[model samples]
Target: MPNSTSILSPIDVERIRKEFPILHQQVNGRDLVYFDNAATSQKPAYVIQALTDYYQGYNANIHRGIHTLAERATKAYEATRLTAQQFINAASEQEIIFTRGVTESINLVASSYGRAFLREGDEIILSGLEHHSNIVPWQMVAAEKKAILKIIPVTDEGELDLDGYKKLLTSKTKIIAVNHASNSLGTINPVKEIIQLAHQLGAVVLIDGAQAGAHLPIDVQKMDCDFYCLSSHKMYGPTGTGILYGKKELLEKMPPYQGGGEMIKEVTFEKTTYNDLPYKFEAGTPNIADVIAFKFAMDFITELGKENIAAHEHDLLLYATQQILKLPAVKLVGTATQKVSVLSFRVEGIHHFDIGQMLDARGIAVRTGHHCTQPLMDRYGIEGTVRASFSVYNTKAEIDQLIEGLERIINFMK
Candidate 1:
């Protein structure tokens, strides 16, 4: 549970800073300034230690094991599911299905629920700002089911065109999928409104929360979304571990996502009865250690409180934006009023790749390019932009270094 604290309470930045060991290191003879939080966050010492403890102590397969070590491992692994349930305010642990990441989570839904529920000529709506993970899965499923794929357009400010979305919704719409926050633009979509609208059109909604999971406070029930996906790596946990939350009734109707040991109740040449809610989606041996360690990552966020973390990151965003905007050649991308800590931009007369490379030489890491939102890049008529995303561990001092580096790059290029 999150501590009872004021949202504006000052964060113990130094204490929190100590939790992340990687932040103390140096790169290229300069202090490492990690601004690639949109890609993946640096894991805290507790999370790292948790991973070490799991492998060093109870390195065993989870579930269906009778030994003491197995029981301990299973207990820890299942505990993460409970933590995840609480983290998202989910109805029950049964509603949470573990996967490799958001990509796999979306793919699972596209292959299973999509195959079962969608029919020929049924339409699946995606937004123009969707990551390839959200787009590709729907495309694959739509093609397989002979369904139509529709898109919700974006405005110049990078906000979703709700009017366009409303026009696209119809009786033929079976699924409406969109990201909670744009990875490239940091545009926060009105998912609750979108979900309600989709429900009115008799369509299910899936929110790709890959970017929003760590930064936003999410409640599946409040949002009324049929499905929500999260990537643990983006949230300061290990890679290759994520979650898919689906409504119980909807999950019960969908078939198992994969065929393997734990997903089965009874197996025979004649037929195989599938296991219950979560196990139905989790096939084969799962990433036990990482899943077990993810609880610490969740705990880290809970301890800080999501609102406090968001407020601090918001300060960083505003400061960075104000500083970057003063630069003569810098052009800010994604001017949406509602956004997370992502600040994407491009400098005049300088390629994004060149900016990124020069920044890397100064030990500042920022992502460059389309950020897996090719459609969005196409919409903006730019090849790519340099993206500097923030996390709870980041500081304004680092942003100062970033600004300095960008200024140097711009002047040198000019």
Candidate 2:
């Protein structure tokens, strides 16, 4: 067992746990142990309340109406954008563009920026550890433009090959796209160093921050990344909402992602002029209600302090890692020195899907399969692994339940 003193401090964890009503439930006649946070974090009551209050109290379409409800709605929606700006430390509110999720955000960049700038033989670099959302959009752009797609290799421990990454960078390199943390394996990539190197080569960098928004600190200005993407669902907010952060200069240069009601400043049958920054990319009626509620989620993290939440999750990761490693039939994957509380592993002779189902039977939730990183699994010579991810509301006792369940499963399989 990890030293409790070093691994954990109260940090008012019990009170924090109570804030998430979903954690107080039962599954399969046992207390629920939610270890699948990497998929989407459970919403806290405050965030839920915000959603309810919006629908009941002030539900209205924003930006065009002069009515009181519309003005209030617009104010609340844009306030969340400002909150998102502060959350990621972007230089200005104009840098943030709302989207359905990280997938849409990346596709927006791949379409708008790549179509505008990339040419034949120009290279866009990605990593072996990327989710399918990050990989597929770039592939589409690369194929359309005849641009070359290069990969930064993944090591056995799931860390990116930085030396290899340096080798891949050249004058022809136009973009470098990588995740801040791997959703499947939880490896925190050295995005700052990656950005600096890409800039030196005159290539733009995009950090897919879907996993990091909830667990790590982000400062796009300090990191000097050209583009960054975040998912509200992963960060304890509502589903179907996220943001894309781009440097103002880059955004201004790129073409509009979609043509619709709001993104246009002036329109004619022959010609249309697009709106200003942020609005240029947000084409349709935005996810107003969810966007408004997302502020409460960001506030929840800000008030709790990311560092404090990280320490708590780190404790859970260390404890879980230590306990899992002691199982004779089990083998851990992605042993990166730095990670956010995700543990992926496999037991000998037991399929990952079977393990997930068995754990679910015991009222412990976990994710299994490729986790949308099929290439990473291939790199490890496996089909997939059982992944148990942690959040702020998770406890050491929950981890203990997972361990007890896993041990029984392993014994039974033997």
Candidate 3:
């Protein structure tokens, strides 16, 4: 067992766990051990209740209606935008644009900003650890504009090769799109340094913060990124709601992502004008209730504090990695020096699918696959891995069970 002192100070664990109600549950006659947090975290009661309260009490369309219900809903929904701005330490509420999730947010930038700015022979640089959402959109834009897409290679330890990244940047580079932390490997990229380097080369930077949202401290102003994307579901909020934070000047300059109501200032038969900043990107009716519910998730995190949460989870990662690495037949996939709570590994002489099935039968949930990072998997010369990711609610006792489970599977297979 991991030393409790090293894992989390006792008070911190108790206080953090109390906020997440779903942490107390049973599955298959056993206490639930949720290690699949990287996919989507289980929502706290406060977040769920917020969603219910909004619909039950004040369910109405926002921005256009003058009715009392609409006014209430509008205030609630817009309140989330303000909360999100503070969540990421963005410059203003106008810079925070709501979208479906990280996928839609990235697509918005690729289609709207890429279309408006990119021309032939321009270059877009991406790291090897990007999720498919980040990669495909750029590929689409590159093909459309005849722009070049360059990849930054990954080291054997699953960390970005910063030297290789430096070589890829050039005067013609239009955008540098990379993830803040790799979903598959849990490798935390040096985004501040990456952004600084990209900016020196005259490239705008967009960071995919899907994996980093709940785990890391995000300050868009401090990071100096041109754009940042985050998903609400990954942060203990609703599934369909997410945010995109862009610099005010850049958002003002970019064309509207989608054409519809709420995004226009004025429309005439001959000419139409776009609304300022955020509305220009949020075209039609958004997932309003989810957006409203997302405020609770943000509040939950804020109350507990991101630094404290990260410290607790960091202990879980260290404990899990130490235990898993001691297994003779186990081969860890990502060994980056800096990482989140993801523990991705492959067992010798057994397929990852088999390992996952056996673990699931023991009432332990984990994600097993390329994890939407096919290019990263290909680069590492592996088909997939079994990923056991951690969250703040997880305990050292759970990590011990996971280690014991893996040991049994390896011995049985042998």
Candidate 4:
């Protein structure tokens, strides 16, 4: 069963904000109103404490030493793997392979799985809404293997064209990769339906859950996606650490992504054998401190409740969307009925960069660029958008600050 409560209590946004130390600071001589959560979230006190505790308590290399510090460190690190397995509801901890974030996770699959399976004339399906991490890796594989790349179209409203997706499937299609929720547009693609359709055509699916990991309830088993990826920093954890979850059978068959250290069972000049499941993919020392601290990040979301977080963020999205649309010549980029708390838009005759700068001066931080989805920006015939993404700690008061900031920018610049 999913982690939710029948009795949905309203989120105490003020109390939640208190957990984040960064929220208490002043940026540009004004109270910080952080809406750039889609890029990375501000860490809470406990999460930071987790890092300090690990280094101060038991900082040692894992899985090799018989010493006490090594055992303690190893236990904490592997415990996070199990926590992540339950966080996303992966079938087993063996399926969770820690990596350098979503970019490296996708590259791991494209390099290992693509090398093992993808062949000449095979087709790989992707979406127009995918982040460049999802796009460029497969593009490299397609180019190398002489395979073809197909895209599921996006509508003017920024929703995926399900009908367009159906039209693209063929026997030659070997793989399909898409984001669980688009980072740029916050369009929640019908991932389960997409996975089912791809399965019927005998193609495996990979869902980039970098954005969804923080905002949405994810069950890899329920979604039945062949692979999933996450960025720890996007979920309020430390940077340089993330997860790549694949089915045990699939991971068993795929070759190791990197060599040396814990990834190998035994090594010699004559021959080398890989370790089992996750260890096979996790190379080198791994992001030990961040991985240990990530447990607190997982605990933070779980303790607050995923449904509660979604509810709070949804309210922020609605309020921000309503207030921003009331401004002159302002157009919302994505109008997807089903979305998380990401609000991306642009005012007519104002460059997105200028809007970003003006808002920053008001102590309102937001993401302004293609949001690593340049192709998605190109689809709308715009250079980029001003993206204000919300999180559980955000409040309606912050949204008002954003609205006021935008209103002043439009009025002064025009």
Local distance difference test, per candidate? 0.93, 0.93, 0.91, 0.93
TM-score of each prediction: 0.98, 0.97, 0.96, 0.98
lDDT of 4: 0.93
Give candidate 4 regions above 4 Å deviation. Answer: 1-7
Off by over 4 Å in 1: 1-6
Give each prediction's root-mean-square deviation over alpha carbons.
1.3, 3.2, 3.3, 2.0
Per-residue accuracy of model 4 over 307-394 as CA lDDT, tens digit each: 8889889988999888998999999999999998899998899999999999999999999989989899899998999999999889
Model 2 alpha-carbon miss at residue 271, Å: 1.6
**Clashes per candidate (backbone, < 3 Å):** 0, 0, 0, 0
Task: Give the per-residue Cα lDDT of candidate 4 at 3.
Answer: 33
Residue 120, model 3: lDDT of: 99
**Runs in model 3 with CA error above 4 Å?**
1-11
Preferred candidate (lDDT higher): 1 or 3:
1
For model 1, residues 1-414, the per-residue Cα lDDT tens digits are: 224466668677777778889989889989999999999999988899999999999988988989988999999999999999999999989999999989999999999999999999999999999999999999999999999999999999999999999999999999999999999999999999999999998899999999998899999889989999999999989999999999999999999888999999999999999998789888999999999988888887877888988898899999999999999989998999999999999999999999999999999999999999999999989999999999988889999999999989888877
